[model samples]
Target: MEFDSEEEAYDFYNAYGGRIGFSIQKEYGNKVNGRIISRALVCSKEGVKGTDKQDRRIFSVQAIDVELASDLRVLACNAYELMGRKSSGKESIGYLKVDLKNYLRTRRQKELLYGNAA
Candidate 1:
């Protein structure tokens, strides 16, 4: 689903993750030019290990601008789709592929539009 703010996005996932068999394991703050511009919600199976690592699956939400934020929404939705598919199949690691896709898409788009927005 589309979110109007980063907090809303995070809240939605955090609140529903447990019911869906995963939980928010970590939150990542993203900076751009020394300013906080985005946040990522990391999720894993209820009993998964090493959740506090950089290699976990995540759903990112950005507060860059209207247009860019819309892109971020799309990325988040795509991540949600992957999470649903993988969780349903009981393939925890498979979800990371979707996270990687979103991450790469976010990076490429930010580079092309915001240049150094990382």
Candidate 2:
């Protein structure tokens, strides 16, 4: 595909991303005489998966359970509820159970490391 201008390209990709349930971002541009000559648009989620960022959120939920001695199920429910509020009817993710399991395993490792395990 070809576009007459960078703005037009951006708008086209942005709309495409919206239709595909993601967002587009301007990655970078080549400048010549203070004018954008070339640019790249990409999905906002590019190169972001399998990172510790989302794990950090899970750790936050783990903190709540540790401090309040809360039930894991309730914590998962509340976390998913909050995530859903930010999205539409679609759930935050399908990995809540896996996250909870990771949290429990991590907590056990920590307890063992700090002599808190029974």
TM-score of each: 0.31, 0.37
Residue lDDT tens for model 2, 17-104: 8998999777544444456555657688754335343442343433454334334444645655544343332233323545655665
Candidate 1 Cα lDDT to native: 0.52
What is the Cα-based TM-score of model 1?
0.31
Error of 2 at 45 (Å): 1.4
Number of backbone collisions per candidate: 0, 0
Off by over 4 Å in 2: 47-118
Tell me the whole-model lDDT of each prediction, alpha carbons only.
0.52, 0.56
lDDT (Cα, 0-100) at 45 in candidate 1? 43
Candidate 1's residue-wise lDDT over 1-118, tens digit each?
6577777887789889878877785444544444434455677543444555455654423223223534566555555444444334323332344455566677678788966654
